[model samples]
Target: MSGDPADEQLVRQAQGGSRAAFDMLVLKYQRRVERLLSRSVRDPADVADLCQETFLAAYRALPGFRGESAFYTWLYRIAVNIAKRHRARQRPLESLEDGEGTFGTDAAPSDDATPEALLANRQLVRGLDEAVQALAEDQRRALLLREVDGLSYDEIADLMDCPPGTVRSRIFRARESLSARLRPLLEGRGGRRW
Candidate 1:
């Protein structure tokens, strides 16, 4: 039963049949859940639905929650599971090589950029996406949770169910791998690293 005292208190209230307490938790984390789901689910409507589904499932399972992890961590797992299932039913994950979307740098090119510059930017983004996709699952997850989600190492460790040292190591390895893979692309562009 270790977590934020506020969340722990809320959980106890919810477990004791307090719907308002549960609603407060939902209000607090709904945006975060939506953000997490949006990473995998492209459709805004689908993301909204999945967010609702996640909360519904969490509410039903509240009684059984033993506070092994932080409430948000547990909720995060539920959101992730819901998103994964939604993705599996929709389509295979989009790929960088598909040329339909960019993963890392979503910024559109400046208005005055030449066609070649736009093409190069696209290539750089594609390269980063490919490099990221090539990482081992654990490394990829750790890196994304840290870099993209802005989660602290300790928070990532809690979500990942590993030590903070392991989270740091995984992020380090993932970054090293990305740098190695992207070195050629970066060097080709005047040695600038994005």
Candidate 2:
């Protein structure tokens, strides 16, 4: 983590239109922005667009930024907003019944699926991952904030600029969606599904 003083210095330079300083800021926060975008916008291409939008918005808004929130907190807020806009502007995913396949990024398939019918297990895991990617934007956001970023509900609420209760509910809904989608795969002896 950058020390408070270093953060403040960068913030000031970014606000003053120091391109290198702003680029550094973007580098520092890119992963968080990418994660935020991934949860809100399932397509890797869309996520990339949102990440760019997040940084651009942050650059525009930096001059007026108050230190009331941590810099990262504020930056995340921009990413969330950018992702929301992207989701809103784009057509949503077709339903599971509609034959769309895959969600989020994939790791190369491994034999972690059922030993008996490895291909079937791989398909099952892939389906569940798609279901997670197909989650509602708010639910995906909250779940990723908790699971991926390891943020507290309150902290998530702050980043989301919503109430903690809302954050908790989104998390619950997201988990339900994931669990329901993954139950079949999890039922097997292998036990765990990533």
Candidate 3:
């Protein structure tokens, strides 16, 4: 068993059909799954239901879960997929006419959003953009390429003419700088740490 008994060992036991082990996994990750779902699900009741569905789906698929990826990574992917499906079922609000022409939905907004909430969101986005802009050129490019462009670290390294390790370091540093700048704005907001 791994030194962290609650992780690998519980997964192994759960795979062997131990209900208690499976229940333990659910208990450990319930809060995290709910928090993740809350990002795309506005209703508290809906978030709770989705969390249950996610765990149920994970349980059914447990037999096929190879040990290739960490258990949490596998579970996280399942939760995100469930949340995406839940969001897709919600009706979209009116389409924007800004040439971009994208549809909006209540799923993307908090259920209790007021004018103040909208302003706070806009301010947060502006603050993040400013933080990104304040980064060094190389760091900014590396971060954006990885995040906004969704490029692999190796791909980013090739484009930036740097080693993959260097790209990773640059991205980490950039995130640290941005996090430092945004910490105060996010403090006491009950947001996820990462």
Candidate 4:
């Protein structure tokens, strides 16, 4: 009903056990929370559970919020920790898929093409995927958050607990690495190009 209601007021109301206030907060943060989790989570479906857990934790700690940092910062920290922990817990069974066998002999994902174009596309994706995989973890995370999850640099910084400058640097490095890695594909030198 007003021009941009304040988040602090909403938070205070939520903290006081106002379900409507909490719902508003949830609606405001839902997309961001999902994006933050999706940046690292392989299975997007699993993001729902993680988002809930993050919010649950936030709700529990809401009263303790000192406002030392913005609410989104605090929420971002919770989301990142939850995502990182979830990633860590699944790490033993999960790997970056090293070696030729994991990616197949082609070194890429299947192409969206047919017949003559099919093999070429697959090689393209493979080369691109490998290039992305080769990036350093921090760079890869930033790049993935942007390219895959479609998050803004500010959102990425929040999720990574870093400054926007750092996020930009990582993404730049990642794009460079990926471009170099995929260069062969672009030139049709790696496998096939037309």
The lDDT of each candidate is 0.85, 0.73, 0.74, 0.74
Please give, for residues 59-125, the per-residue lDDT of candidate 4 as tens digits. Answer: 9999898766667778878998898899878854333343231133453435554566766655665
**Could you tell me the lDDT of residue 190 within candidate 4?**
53
Model 3 score (lDDT): 0.74
**How many pairs of residues collide in each model?**
0, 0, 0, 2
| Residue pairs with clashing backbones, model 2 | none
Q: Model 4: runs farther than 4 Å from truth?
A: 1-5, 91-114, 146-159, 189-194
Worst 10-residue lDDT window, candidate 2? 96-105
Cα error, residue 3 of model 3, in Å, equals 10
Point out the worst 10-residue segment of candidate 3 by lDDT.
95-104
Segments of candidate 1 deviating more than 4 angstroms: 88-93, 96-112
Q: Of 3 and 4, which scores higher on TM-score?
A: 4
Model 1, 55-120: lDDT tens digits are 999999998999989999999999988887887787665564335332645677788999998888
Deviation from native of the Cα of residue 115 in model 2, angstroms: 7.2
**What local lDDT score does residue 63 receive in model 2, on the 0 to 100 scale?**
83
User: In candidate 2, what are the lDDT values of residues 61-176, reduced to their tens digit?
Assistant: 88889777778888877786676677678786653433333342244556564466665555675676577677886787678778878999988887788999999999888888
Off by over 4 Å in 3: 1-5, 93-194
Indicate whether candidate 2 or candidate 4 has the larger TM-score.
Answer: 2
Model 1 poorest ten-residue lDDT run: 96-105
The candidate that wins on TM-score is: 1
TM-score per candidate: 0.82, 0.72, 0.52, 0.69
